[model samples]
Target chain A: MSVTSLASQLQGLAPADGSYADLFSSVLPAVIDAIGEIASSLSTAHRVALAGTANTFGDDQLNVDVAAELVLRNTLAAKCPSVVTASSEEDPVEKPVHSEAAAVATRPEHCYTVAFDPLDGSSIIAPNWTVGTILGIWEGPTAVGQPAEKQIAAVLGVYGPRTTAVVAIRLPGSSKADAASSICLEIGLGQGQQASQNSEVLRSSVRLAAPPFKTRYFAPANLRAAAQDGRYMALVSNYIQQGYTLRYSGGLVPDVVHALVKGHGVYVSPVTAQSKAKLRQLFELFPIALIVECAGGLAIDPADGSRILDRVLQGTDERAGLVCGTAEDVEAVKKALLA
Target chain B: MSVTSLASQLQGLAPADGSYADLFSSVLPAVIDAIGEIASSLSTAHRVALAGTANTFGDDQLNVDVAAELVLRNTLAAKCPSVVTASSEEDPVEKPVHSEAAAVATRPEHCYTVAFDPLDGSSIIAPNWTVGTILGIWEGPTAVGQPAEKQIAAVLGVYGPRTTAVVAIRLPGSSKADAASSICLEIGLGQGQQASQNSEVLRSSVRLAAPPFKTRYFAPANLRAAAQDGRYMALVSNYIQQGYTLRYSGGLVPDVVHALVKGHGVYVSPVTAQSKAKLRQLFELFPIALIVECAGGLAIDPADGSRILDRVLQGTDERAGLVCGTAEDVEAVKKALLA
Candidate 1:
């Protein structure tokens, strides 16, 4: 599809997750802290204020929480990921001034935020904060139930963020030696716009899904988050018990975008993906296949690896499925289910 | 204006003080019990779970204390008001039903819910559930500095169920002796839909600002306990003196709905209300006014006592303002402001 068509298609795809996963995920860690901060604010707000009991959330409390949560998200994104860019309520990203002074060279890969709401339903009244979340994204899923491991042996091999997980993609022009910058980088595509060779680069070092696998789906929305979830696999069913999370937020763009920046991939429901042939219809099979392979992962039909999208596009009806974890995880599920 | 149009016009336009006053008054009694129950629940929940160091809410060792205060708005709304509803997540308004026929119609006027937020912050996270809401909702705005006499002496004074206050407009066939049942009958339109001769109700409430006012705005989204809090005429806002609530949720419907139902009127901002006029906008005004007026409270411009959508055409701007207390309290605010 043309860039405009692709962008439109993606926008029409409903963020792959519902409402705003990024919005929620991005704000979670700070939200965690804000609960405490606001609690303090409320407590010390007054000692001699009221003679008796009055039930209410003083105005001062709300403002404190909102401001605190915003700061936490921004601060975490800057440090945790390489190219942490986002479109949130607080600030919009402005196009950087095109400085042609140091031109002629390949654009640097940028780091951005990749997030999944580690916590959902974290709300409480006057007293305490409820719920928790992790929003940064990453490369691939790991074995189920294993604590996220750290990169260096000395440091625990943790996959997601302490508060959130992150995700991003590697760029053709980027080099393996470009790991000096604290933040990762990425080339952000417009809503639904197909990624291109000329797009900016970002961190693609950590593959989101661990048990990398080749996969295919027919649902449009699920396909988006699965593909963007970085695992090229959705954190669909937790059957495999991998460390990677298969999230559902009820939107396509935000979910995918979230996964993209965090190095995770987006996903679609197997049923929706196959009925509309959404994934194949949107992405050229070979190129998408190549991209998934290039990202050091595998892709296949969630039902059965043998019945790949290229192999059996017309014969399937039971299409709802997941797209996450390592190749082994996908292969295991496919082996277990595909008839 | 026709009921439909009236409901539509008065949707967001609240007698700011009215709602505030109502919430404060209603919650006081409910709070007394809510705290008592949570003290038991937290202790039991922790005991049941057997988590270590998780201090039970009822314990005396902890210095946790919960109170609501109203501040700032005294100058802004004339009557310093803060709205609070304390109850368990369970709905308030319990009623004994004899048969299926009455059961359906007897859908309790309220549900019990303890939104007792932590008295402190993460400072209290050590006990986890230590900081949460104790449900309480009052229906009117008694002076913030008044004695507890007002809360205990209200028309609708039940603490077990969630509603700190329940608003009811007598039906064409109802009588004064059946006010509670009549009010229960109108729970659907109990907020501000049906008008009764001399029947005034207290909707939900909020809190915000610095010190002095006993109410504060914890932002409705976070004010879970308040959703079920309500009382009539004898409003709380009694004990905590910090400030009044300024509930805002960036316009999420359910959260706002809860506030409207439990509030004397709903409070929203210009962008949130999504209109240039506060009372005129349909989306912003209808739902809120329906809540406030149907319950017998007035739906006037918080700033000017001129009826909000009461303008002949009921057209107003989206600069959605605070839904003050009961008609009396609202007038007091305008009077204070004008004075």
Candidate 2:
């Protein structure tokens, strides 16, 4: 059977107004290519070793993480002139990009700001568990202070036994009539080939199954929070009593993406006085929330039970708890956590 | 950096006495190839669909399971003459193999019996999560009525974003002075290449960390059992209270392998009145127990806390609960459950 590639699928999602045409055509594919390179390099023993440095968040960095950040940054700067600024989990502040490639007359409206976690789940990488790279492309020079809905597209590069990516695109200000325009695509990257060539679109226009799902699953991130908060503990207990299958892999990208692929799972990360939530807004939460929402799921702030997309991004390093997945499961999380 | 392939590692582990030379050289490589073929076939959409047939255990079999069993059965039949009998999870009864290829004079000592779960965790395959193949190689024509320790070798093929296999070899009657003879190797299969050619030895000799692990992790299978057994609930509660990380991925192969790769995790599958444990003793438990034991870890019967390897295989369909991983964590599970 024939399969469509990621580039072709992205081409189909590109808007008539050309709002994110450059991102769809250039920036995202480069990011995917960079991820493929990282996947190949990960098999080397030295790359998986500790880099002896910490990220901005004080998490110990692996050699793969440092190499991944560099590869992504360099790929974006060299290939995507439309990417005016970029920030990574390793270096949280926004940095200028493509200074030599983009002319002074380059249109700010056409340019995009990229925020990414170059190598997420680094702690679990040594074990060779599935980890990922998360990216959100915003329509302007920076993602700071912008509502998550203002983002044009998001891509999650999953590095597991295979290198695959989840690419979701939603044009800003699209109406309900244009709902079909929002798309989520799961694509497989060929091991040693360019992202545009051998990449296969595994799933197109991905959406969760309508709820009252036949089987329910729960991924409780930061389970430590349950110790300090009785409500969180109660929520987990309820999941167990209801026979919800536990699918947490202790990695944000895999856990969230698993829910999407299964078409029925709830992933809850709650904040508590003793255990603070550590998911960064720009690098992780916003991108993941967009992909979930575009795929007919819900992503919400666990504390206030508001749509995560509606919360404006205050800074690059802003952290928050998220309740995301099948709409019904997310709603259940809100009710249980807020009670 | 130069990397050692799985073939070379197996060659190194092959004993000069030639007890399991055929298994290490022929049968095991054939099994890995079958897994590689299954991995390649899994990407097709049709293979992931339901097969409308149930295994002997009454679980719904996916098309992949049916196809995987055929692929493995055929590969073994065609390539490995040393395999005298084989049985699979789908068809639990042991069946004779290679009647034409193997003469009546074929030595029983050299001939091996194989019991396998062609596709363990088939229930979770639809979501494109990692699943695996489990196999135990007995020294004689039949694994039935033989103790698990009598098995000379075990292989686990993991199909995830990448295809990999954990092959463990422990010659029957090996002494403690020859402990190094029992080796567990984690190998990566090349996506589109032969098992022996492109496969890399990801980890040469796999082992668990010593007790008092700085970071602890737990994978609690059959969480629903907590409702019927207060001790199970208390065990889970203690894990949370001790701040042990949860790393369950809902697939038996991935959960157990995660503990092996992490070097510190306890996987508990408990039996209660309401939730009868479903892991088959021969196909799933014996193979996994061998690998864990070979890797310097412990695999025990959750009910009585005896070494799982000491159990005799009465039938292919016998099922039991298991608590396996780092010795310390397994000790903790026995203490909490047996209290």
Provide the global lDDT of candidate 1 against the true structure.
0.27
Per-residue lDDT over A1-339 for candidate 2, one digit per residue giving the tens place of the 0 to 100 score: 237666666676777776677877888778788878877666443224322211122267666778888888888877887888899988999999877437465644588889999888766554445778899888888898887767878888877645667888886566211137587877767766365566766666667888566667899989977878889888888888878878888778888877777777889999988877789989998899889988888899998999888778888889989999988789988998998
lDDT of 1 by residue, B79-130 (tens): 1122312221121222121244533543434321112122212222221312
**Candidate 2 residue-wise lDDT, B1-339, digit = tens:** 226655556776777776677877788778878878877776443323322211122267666788888988788777888888899899999998767536465644578888889888755554445678898888888988886767888888877645678888886467321136588877767656366556767677777777666677899998988877889988888888888888887778888887777677899999988888799999999889889888888888888988888878899899999999888788888988988
Quote the positional error of residue B286 for candidate 1 in Å: 22
Question: Individual DockQ of the candidates?
Answer: 0.02, 0.34
What is the CAPRI rating of model 2's predicted complex?
Answer: acceptable
TM-scores for chain B, in order? 0.27, 0.92
Provide the TM-score for each candidate, comma-separated.
0.26, 0.89
Cα error, candidate 2, residue B278 (Å): 1.3
Q: Candidate 2: deviation at residue B147, Å?
A: 2.0
Evaluate residue A315 in candidate 2 and report its C-alpha lDDT on the 0 to 100 scale.
Answer: 85
Q: Compared with the true structure, what per-residue lDDT tens digits does model 1 show for residues A126-187? A: 11122222232222221112111100000000011011112222222232211331122222
